[model samples]
Target: MAQDDTPSAFRLPDPAVVSRTMADVAERGQRIVQDFLKRQSDNASNGGGTGGAGSDPLNLAGAFMEMTTRLMSNPARLMQAQIGFWQDYMTLWQHTARRMMGKETGAVISEDPKDKRFKDDAWRDNEIFDFIKQSYLLSARYFQTAAASAEGLDEKSAQKVDFYTRQFVDALSPTNFALTNPEVLRRTAETGGENLLKGLSNLLGDLERGKGSLQISMVDRSKFSVGENIAVTPGSVVYQNELMQLVQYNPSTEKVLKRPLLILPPWINKFYILDLRPKNSFIRWAVEQGHTVFVCSWVNPDESLAEKGFDDYMQLGPYAALEAIEKATGEKNINAIGYCLGGTLLAATLAHMAAKRDTRIKSATFFTTMVDFEEAGELSVFIDEEQLQALEDKMNKRGFLEGSEMAGTFNMLRANDLIWSFVVNNYLLGQEPFPFDLLYWNSDSTRMPAKMHSFYLRRMYQQNDLIKPGAVDLLGVKLDLRKIKLPTYILSTREDHIAPWQSTYRATQIYGGPIRFVLAASGHIAGVANPPASGKYSHWVSDTAPPTAEAWLEGATELAGSWWPDWHRWVSALDKAQVPARTPGDGALAVIEPAPGSYVKVMASD
Candidate 1:
């Protein structure tokens, strides 16, 4: 509902099955039933098993009887639910009769106030429509309650059922139907059926582009370009390696912190999420705050880099950038920030540095990164043994995991906003996607190398290795979060599904440092990119570090403004004396091009 200039950092599936598979399954089932029947017939004909003619029919129907008994285990609960439903229906009927007798102005079946779909007057004004809407809503509520009340289901299985139930309920909304939706019908008449034709064309285009699947593009790509329009933060690409490019932003302040700020963004996405246009650019903001900013622009890895593992990223990404930043700024000590997966890598790199006694990293900042994957939210659902094997098989076929696959996973977390909303707007309404810079960045996805991705999932999500000391060996050392004692500032978004705030809060427990964890409002991208100038959303802050994330929330003070200023203050305290601004290529590292280097421009492989 609110405005966000930057897209979600998470910007962020196919079915093809021959009929032969289903036919085979059907034939197999048929054979089993036929064979069982034949066995019974043979036994009866020979009188080898039992005498059927003399036997009671109930004895022959034993299997059916057993199944029915098993199904009615909670007969009391079933009866109570039936009684409750009938009671509610009768009450509604009585209320409706009263309303019809001029005692009430509206229908007894009022839509749930919490229901966002039927907020329009049309749904409320017509008693018939209101009844239909309310009935569906009530039914949906009952279904969800039934799902929650289900026995013998694990938490994950119950959650999956609940999520699917929501999807089912969302799909059947009155707004999605043409005839039931007055607004859509009104638009249809106003357009003289033009909208329908355009919708068909749009649907066909999507199916064609998506290879028989519907992929609703969130932005009009034709209206925007990466460097020119969206990622327009003023900076120069000062350093490059096989894994990443370091961009040194042009300084806004005359003097800057002696300890230069180095950013490690997730290779899963382009680095421009931090530099999304000048107005909301975090990189631009850092430069203006008298800090020398260097961002890592990760390569859109292809098949050639499939074998590149997590260790490769550690050495080539942060380590390489650290060397380049030191050379460029002549600053021995550096302040570092890592975002999402980037933050996870930063934590590992920090631990590695601690083991080697490398003190170049003075202060560490993490933006929505998870060190412990114990409560990894919905993402854990995709990381089981079977799913991992399937993913590996898919990635093996194509050296790198496709960007769209990653995007789809994140989109599933918020299907209404990311998927169905687009479905209604782009396909049903036949409208061109909005020309949004954030959405454009979201659409411009990047690939992940197979080996690196596999290692990451297995180690972090599957094995739960990173947080455990001596569990994960990276760069010839056991990666331990407890070893790192650098001054740390960790931030997590309140509404982030990708890196849930509570999951991110685990870092405070793992990191053996003076860690300050702040919970910002909004989602993954918007939360981090929020500018104080906009004054859009409020953030929660506290000095106390509690054992549990919930306890932290209880003590945290709700502050009105962006967390950027708080971060600037925190980093300022740790920084050395201010020195004159240093330009890109002014020191050891030579300039390659402008900021947002060639790596970002490389489109996802077809």
Candidate 2:
């Protein structure tokens, strides 16, 4: 085979960095040797002691013995689990063999239906491929058993072990292997091994780009620009402050709802999630429904904005937007909606308004937002004393948390789907990532201010301060959710990993109002973004607030289609009669530019 010459694909980093790294590594090696010798000498002086039992090499042996003993102690349960695994394995083999022999096997063996790699016909048609799939499945089952068998480990530590083990298992799947992956092999043949060359190129490119780590290209950054491809809802930047840009979308109907709708989207990411595509856009949908909508497009923070804290967000974010909306629309009251972290701020603003006896916001809607941080889910794992301190140190140095750093933490929460899938596709298979709007939005993260990020994580996540009345002070006012008496609409996703449905449901008890909590199907983003056209998922609705989330779920009526229509009807009831439609600049506030605003366009420094 002739070696097909391809141009060198990637540039090497500066040679100065390589030299510095080499010198630093040598210095570190010397330091490590010296430390080890010092430690040994200290141990000898201390009567041949090496810390305690946990640190002793013999204790590691004892730990292994304890593990074996625990396994031995649970012989019956172990035997039962092992037997069940073997039964499943045997069934899979029989089915695979029968299928390969061109015999009809009615029901296929699948441990996890979510695993898509085995769905390919090539895996079933080829005997070797079939065996490989079965083998991996069987191994995965064994790994689950092994993980379950482990005892005496902390919950978080155990979870880490299980998670990494699963990642290892998933990485070893036939789909990732060059020979077993049909698509890679086919492309290799068609391209005369150029696919492999490109794959190597992609790998090198990611390495050079990501520096040392693999930052898999999850989104086609070039495909979607802020105002062009997405966030195209017709609107104008009515007001600009240091923290956010207030966008009042142009009304689509002749008669709009009397009360204006103000959106507070999470600053953790760009605000365009609510306005992704015309069909899927919530802002567009709301406008078509005869409502005056406004959204706060948050400014991506840098070192200059590092001093901006949660208080700044409260004062300049919702409060400032409320004043601007009132000024523009000539409506005394506004219907405010908050998503995720934005929701938290919105709740705080409501409490602040309640304290001041302000009637600017008549009604409120929270989308997959958590007021009670007691059950913030997997995100809490990354927040602790040591972790927070380390994070603070990083923020202190940089003045803001890097968007990539924040995004990396989120990607870790769903590593298999968000991280490894891209790794296999982009680097291993040498494929450009499929255009996904959600992923594109997710990749477009915003930096968090040092003071603001620290305050949010420590006060909300670590201490669970938000749930306690008067515990959190925002803008010189103690935030008490119970003070909020306006009619509230809460939408929590049944499968939300970020804000668990229960924690979101807890918001019902926090506020002093008639709460209409709806449990939407799918995860955090998808549930909220669900459109009526898809007809894919269903949502649960409850008229009366229940004692617990489980209780609410039990009595809840499952409704078909998107929850948007249901919410629209609910909000319409709270709002006044229809009035003449108002354009962005038609009001007192002048329009700066089109919708999606300039604040959202401002990119965080790399």
Q: What is the C-alpha RMSD of each candidate to the true structure, in Å?
A: 12.2, 8.1
Model 2, runs deviating above 4 Å: 1-109, 151-155
Q: Count the backbone clashes (under 3 Å) in each candidate.
A: 1, 0
Q: In candidate 2, what are the lDDT values of residues 285-328, reduced to their tens digit?
A: 99999989999999998899889999999989988888898789
- Please provide, for model 1 over 60-98, each residue's C-alpha lDDT reduced to its tens digit, 9 standing for 90 to 100: 233334433533676677667667767766666676566
Q: Which pairs clash (backbone N, Cα, C closer than 3 Å) in model 1? A: 7-438
TM-score of 2: 0.83
Every model's TM-score: 0.85, 0.83
The lDDT of each candidate is 0.79, 0.81
